[model samples]
Target: MNLKGKNVLVTGSEGFIGSHLTEKLVEIGAKVTALVQYNSFNSWGWIDTFDKNIKENINIVTGDVREYDSVKRIVKGQDVVFHLAALIAIPYSYLSPMAYVKTNVQGTTNVLEACREYDVEKIIHTSTSETYGTALYVPIDEKHPLQGQSPYSASKIAADKMAESYYRSFNLPIATIRPFNTYGPRQSARAVIPTIISQVLAGKREIKLGSLSPTRDFNYVKDTAEAFIKIAESDKTIGEVINAGSNSEISIGDLAHKIIRIIGEDVKIICDKERIRPEKSEVNRLWADNTKIKQLTEWTPKYSLEEGLTETVDWIKNNMEYFKTDIYNV
Candidate 1:
C-alpha cells in the first residue's frame, strides 16, 4: 500500500491532528483533498495557517461530515480515507450529548458508508483513549474493557464499533488508530496541555485545572500523525485497532508542574471546582500499551514528554492571541 502517489482524503483536515496529517500526506507526494467543516467565515481552521506553497498543493473542500452526500462527494476516487472529524470536547458533550451522537456516531457511519461505496483502498478511523475510561489495569491494551464515563467517550465508543462492523459486514478495508492524549501546536485551548500552557504564558502564577489525580499517556501530535500514515500503509492493519502512544503515564499534577518548570515559572496549582467533571464521569487514569502499533507498523513516538511540552510551550507562547487565558474554555 504505497501512499506516495495515491489519492488521500482526510476528513477534519482543518483541525489540530488532521491538519498535521494532511501536511504529512502532502510531503509524501500524495494527491490530497482536505475536508473542512463548512462555515460562513470560510475558515479552514489551522489549515489556514499553512504557507502559500503548502496550501497550493492541497485541494481544500468545505463540507460537513454529518451530511451523507457531502461525505460521499469528497470520498470519491480516494485511495485512502482518514476519518478524523468528530465533536471531541468532553464537557460540551455533557451539555449536548445528542450532538456527540449526531456528529461522532452518525458522522462516522457516513465516512464508513461513503468509503465502502467508493471502494477506497483503505480507511483509518480515529479513536480515543477516553473510551477506555479509568483503566481497570495498568498500561491499557486493545483488549481492555471499554468504559464510557463521559458522553464524548461514549460517542467515540459507538463510532469505533461502527468502523468494526463495516469491516466485518461489508468487508471495508478499515483500521482504527486509537491515540492517547495527543498534544502539540494548533491544539485547542479546551485541551489540558493548551489550557495549562496558555495560562502560564499569560503570566498567571496560579494555574487552575480539573482533577490532578488522573494519569494519562500523552503522545506528541507528530507521532500520532505518523501512526496514521504507518497504519494506512501497512497491509497487516486492516480490520485492526492499534494504539498510538508514548506508553508512559503522567499524573495531571505532575504534568502541570513539568510544564511550569520548562517555562521557568514559579506557579501554584489550584483546583477549580468549575473545571471538574462529575465524580463518575471523570476518567481517573489512562496508560497505553503501544505494542500493537509498533508490531504492525513502523511507528514509534519520536518526542519525549519534556521535549513535546517544550515545543508546545513555544507554540502557545507565539500563538497566545488565539487563546483566551482569562476564561475557562468550555
Candidate 2:
C-alpha cells in the first residue's frame, strides 16, 4: 500500500509520537487529517512545533476520541486510521482510573467502530510495553502474558483486547503496533528521557527521579513512526500485534547518569518519593523481542540509544522554555 496518494487519519496528532507520525505521513505525500483534542484555547499540542510548510498540508480536526459521532466523522473517507490517542500518564491514571477507561478503552472502541463502519482498508492501533507489567522474562515478545500493574496499563490492556476482538468478530483490518518506551523531541516531562534532559539542561544540581531500578527498552520516536508506516504497508500485519523496539535495556539510574554525562553536568541523583509509583504498581523491567515486526515488515531501529539521547538533549536545550522544569508534570 503506497501512502503517496492515500488519505490518512491520525488520532492524537497533537501528541509527541502522534505529531511525529503525522509529519512523516505528510512528508511521504499522504493527505493527513490530524485529530487533536479540542480545547477552548484551540492549541494543537506538539503540532504547533511543526514547520509552516508541513502544517499547511495537514487538516486539523478538533474532537474527543471518546465521542462516537466525532470519531466516526473524522474517520470517514480515509484509507487508513492510525489511532494513537490515549491517556498515557501512569501517575495520573492512579488518581483517575475511570478517565483512563474512558479515553484508552472506550476511546479505542470508538475508533474501531468507525473503521468497521467505514470499511477502512487498514487500522493501526497503538499499544505500549507497559501492558507487559514487568519483565517476567527478558526480551518480551507478543506472547508474553499481560499483567496490568497500574491503572494506565490496565486500561491499555482492555483497549488492546478490544482491538483484537474487533479483528476476530467483525474482521476489522486491524494491526496493533506495540512500541516500547519511545523518546525524542517534543516528548513531555512525564517520560523519563525528557525529565532527565529537562532537569539537567535547566541547571539543577540535584536531579530528582523515581524508581531508579526499573529498566526499559527505549526506541527513538522516528524509528517508531517508521515502523508504523511499514506495518501499514505490509499485508501480513493484518490482525497481528507487532512490536517496535531496539531490543536494548537500560535502567532508569543508568539512563539518568548517562544523560548527565552527555550534558557534561555534575549533578547528584536524588530519589523523589512523590515522583515514584506505588511499590506494587511499578513495572520493574521491560525488554522487547522485535522479531515479529522484523519478519513482517522490513523495520529496524536506525538510531542507537546514545545517538537518540544526544538528539533529545539538543532538542531540550533549544526548547527549554516549552517545559516547566521545576514542576512535576503529571
Candidate 3:
C-alpha cells in the first residue's frame, strides 16, 4: 500500500491531528482530498494556517461526515480513506450525547459504507484511548475490555464496533488506528496540554483544572501522523486495531507542573469543581501497550514528552493572541 502516487481522502482534515496527517500525506506525494466540516464562513479550520506549498498540494473539500451523500461523494476515487471526523470534547459530549452519536457513530458508518461501495483499497478508522476508560491494568493493550465512562467514549466505542462489523460482514479493508492523548500545535483548548499552555501564556498566576490525579499516555502529533502512515503501508494491519503512543505515562498533577516549568511560571493550580467530571465518569489512568503497533508496523515515537511540550509551549506563546484565554473553552 504505497502512498506515493495514490489518491487519499482524509475526513476531519481541518482538525489538529487530521491537518498534520494531510500535510504528511501530501509530503509523501499522495494526492490528498481533505474533508473539512462545512461552515457558513467557509473556514478550513487549522489548515488555513498551512503554508502555500502544503495547501496547494491538497484538494480541500467542504462537507460533513454525518451526511452520507457528502461522505460518499468525497470518498469516491480515493485509494485510502482516513476517517477522523467526530465530536471529540468530553464535556460537550456530556452536554449533548445525541450529537456524539450522530457524528461519531453515524458519521463513521457513513465512511465505512462509502469504502464498501467505492472499493477503496484501505481505510484507517481513528479510535481514541478514551474507549478503554480508566486503566483496569497497566499498559493497556488492544485486548483491554472497553468501558465507556463518558458519552464521548461511548459513541467512539459504538463507532469502533461498527467499523469492525463492516470488516467482518463486508470484508472492508479497514484498520482501526487508536491513538492515545495526541497533543501538539494547532490543538484546541479542550485538550489539557493546550489548556495549560494557553492559560500559562496568558500570564495567569493561578490556573484552573479538573482532576489532577488521572494519568495519561501522551503522543506528539507528528509521531501519531507517522504511525498512521506506517499502519496504512503495512499489509498486516488489515482488519486490525493498532495503537500509536509514546509508551510513557504521567499524572495530570505532575503533567501540569511539567508544563508550568516549561513555561517558567510560578503558578498555583486550583481544582475547578465545574471542570471536574463525575467520579464514576473520570478515567483515573492510562498507559499504552505499544507492542501491537510495534509488531504490526515499524513506528516509534520520535519526540519525548519534554521535547513535545517545549514545542507546544512555543507554539502557544506565539499564537496567544488568537485565543480567548479568559474564558474556559469547553
The lDDT for every candidate, in the order shown, is: 0.94, 0.95, 0.93
Give lDDT: candidate 1, residue 64.
94
Q: lDDT value for candidate 3?
A: 0.93
- Tell how far residue 128 is off in model 3, in angstroms: 0.4
So what's the TM-score on candidate 2? Answer: 0.99
The true-versus-predicted C-alpha distance at residue 128 of model 2, in Å, is 0.4
Residue-by-residue lDDT tens digits, candidate 2, 182-211: 999999988899999998888889988998
- Pairs that collide in candidate 1 are none
What stretches of model 1 exceed 4 Å from their correct place?
none
lDDT of 3 at 151: 99
Give candidate 2's whole-model lDDT.
0.95
TM-score of 1: 0.99
**TM-score versus the correct structure, for each prediction:** 0.99, 0.99, 0.99
Clashing pairs in 2: none
**Model 1, position 152: C-alpha lDDT score:** 96
lDDT of 3 at 291: 94
Clashing pairs in 3: none
Writing each residue's lDDT as its tens digit, candidate 3 over 36-145 gives 99999999998999999999999999999899999889999999999999999999898999999999999999999999999999999999999999999989999999
